[model samples]
Target: MAESQLLCMEDGLMPTAVPESRPQFYYSEQHRAALERLITGGDGAFKSLLKDENGQDFLSAREITAITSSFVKYKTDEENGGASAGQDKRDDAGSLHSTYWPQMSDTEVPPLDIGWPSSGLFKGVTRVAVHTHPPKDNGPHIKEVVRKLIQESSKVVAIVMDLLTDLQILRDLFEASKRGVPIYIVLDEPGAPHFLDMCNRLQVGARDLQNIRTRTVKGIGLNLSVGRIPGNVQSKYMLIDGDKVMFGTYSFSWSSSRMDRNMITVMSGQVVDFYDNDFRELYAISDKLDLFKQFHMTKPQTGTLSRAAVPKRPAAATSRFQVNLGDVTRGDGKVPAHKYHNPKYLLALGQIPGPTEPLQDFFNKMEPPDPETEQELENPTEELENLTPDPSPPEKKKSKKLKLSFKSKRGKKDKKSDEVIEENPANPSDEASKHTLTRDETQDSLKKKNTECMCVIA
Candidate 1:
């Protein structure tokens, strides 16, 4: 009978023998106590359940809520004689109470509720995660997020950005392209060159060339007929397989990671649909240049000059002289000549003619030297010495003078000369006159000498 009742429950049919009292659907004290402990433990208990056997935390919010609902349904099923009914022939009330309110140690509690919607907007997606830059939580770095998206994507990868200067991200995209994954990129016109260069590098040895396609948007396609001026498409976002999206103010540039203060969120499910749609719209108006054809096109011969072929110089006029030849001369008697004329023949062969007579005369009349120049002439020797280098060596030695001495052996000859000189000293008046001259006589002698010297100079 219990087996039949269990089969009926599985088939979604009510059993024939109903309980006298309505079975309680609410939690017992033991169940409530176990749930309280799980919640109080914060995310520790929840994390254990969310993590897979490999320890990867891939549980979504909706999956967590589903786990909680399953636990409640399982307890209710046992009360309806579901799980232990085939074991033994036990009293109904005792079995039902044991099944509905089991000991906390015996019954395992569910993990914390993740509070995710099970089925709403996006279909087929079972997981969704959000991360911010300058991160609020210990989430994956933006670069890692990008790499994972490209690595896990199966069908297509779409990216839209105003700037993309990150080399690592570019390499990831290149790698994805090599895997034959279709990649669509919409970038600002200025950044289009960078992305295209990366694509070109990947295509070098590739057999399938259509895996990557790129288009350039002008200011993120925001310029609405203001004469086609490039606009600022400042958005930075990427969509993976039309199901996952990673977006924020964080740009796909090196500086954006290390220098700029920005944010990015990695998420999946319904929200991704909106971003994917936006990416497609932006890509539609993008400037789609065929990179394969452009890079492979036959280039013009580079070594040769590109100038147009020279036209044969018009045949020289048959006759040198013409009726209108004189008309070409100007009023000053100057005739127009061909551009090929030698410049040497343009002017007279001799020295240029001087100024007219009155002008020449005016220049010839000399002006006095400036006062400064006249002062400089006052000390011409010093000025000349200053101008020229001295011939004397800087460190020349002085010559010594020779000293002469008379010896005592010549005493007799010296005494004889002294005696002759002493005799004049014996005559006092003659001695005095020989030693001294009067002041008036000295003056008269000096005047006579000056007059004689003057006559010689004249």
Candidate 2:
């Protein structure tokens, strides 16, 4: 005989019953064993049992969150060039790449035609200025850069701001002047700080022999800014020797040196001609230097020159650019204005010379890729292979399993019929209890019948 306790016999042995299938919890001893191995052999050895077969590092979010957080702080430090103090120590070796590296699409090295070398490979550029903002302390490097510019082509140098006689630039001006280099000095307004500085330096100081030969170009224009836009003020730009252009943002001053990121691109090429013509028009007005001295010193002038002068067009009429501005709303509730499209500029572009044929023809003639640039995306089949290692094809998730049950269909139908018959009361003949046995029960039944008979006769 089997034991009275519910014995779930399986495979000829009594097995303990269990609830619906679920994963078993690890015992305290098992957890301690794993932890001991981790402490003794380091995580790598202990991780073998816990890894999902492929040996990839499996770190919980909580374990690696602190490390990932440092990247954000590292990025912030690099953008401001360490200008901000109190950044994380880990990011001290910040990189400039996040800010300065140009995009592939935007990386166009325009041809250095008109004596401006636009080829991507240049040893580098040599830049000389009255003052190089983002100044370098290495005078040798400065000299080298200046020598290269001068040796390369017709080097035109400009004295931006007022030509201060006492400033160190005047020394350079003196040297270049003696060297017979055509240096153009473009001055700001007469009463401006630059204007006053030039006056004090020249009047209170001894006659610099260079001033006799130094040529001045009087300018009427706004300042230049780098990596920033001014509040609706247009800046004036000048081309020196058709090599580079200097566009001013702030009034050239001592305050502008280390305090601001103001700068000018020492660019080369046909671009230089664009700035050269601008200087020419301003120089054209300097012929009346007497009038400049008198009119600027508050003496009343009688001529049309007293009125604000309209700036001259830098490019010739056919090549002139027209600007189109658009308003873009930013996330901070500010509407930033930007250049949308310049139709006139597009018209000028249409005139630019391309390789002797239409754009379609040029594209059709392009050769196939130089295999070095072609990178293949991974194969989906290979990725699937790695994911599945069951030694057999996936079982299709058993979409709908069919099982053989011991209970017959007829048994189910009979059970359902029995339930319905019990729920509804059956006829007396079919009642399970057919009669009442006690005498007191029979007397009560007769009394109820007599009362009914009396009520019917009445």
The alpha-carbon lDDT assigned to residue 296 of candidate 2 equals 43
Best by TM-score: 1
Q: Write the per-residue lDDT of candidate 2 for residues 1-458, one digit (tens) a residue.
A: 12312243345665443322434321223333433444445565556645633333445655334322321211344575755453443346674334564555343322211132222333244543543445556433222333344444244455445423334444554455445455455454342445445644544222223222222343332111211111111334544455576565533444544466554445654445545555555554443233234224343332454777889753222322332122111122111111113344334344233234444454466566434224442454533322222232355432222111122233343221100011112332443553322334434543453333221110
> Mind giving the per-residue lDDT tens digits that candidate 1 earns over 1-458?
23543456475675455432556322222323333333445346646543432343434666445434332211345577665655444645455435464554452332112111122354455465666555566777766777788888777777888777677777777677678677777788777777667556655433334466667776521111111122457878887766677888887878778777776777776677677667756765567756666678442332666899888643233343321223223222222232113244323211222222333344365355444323333345633332222233435312111111222333344321100111122343563566344434544543443333221110
Clashing pairs in 2: 112-116, 112-118, 156-241, 223-248, 223-249, 224-248, 224-249, 225-249
Please list the residue runs of candidate 1 whose C-alpha ends up more than 4 Å from where it truly belongs after superposition. Answer: 1-128, 197-209, 220-228, 297-458
Candidate 2 regions off by >4 Å?
1-155, 160-166, 191-238, 248-251, 290-458
Per-prediction CA RMSD (Å): 33.6, 46.9
TM-score for each model: 0.35, 0.26
The C-alpha local distance difference test score for the whole of candidate 1 amounts to 0.52
Q: lDDT for every model?
A: 0.52, 0.38
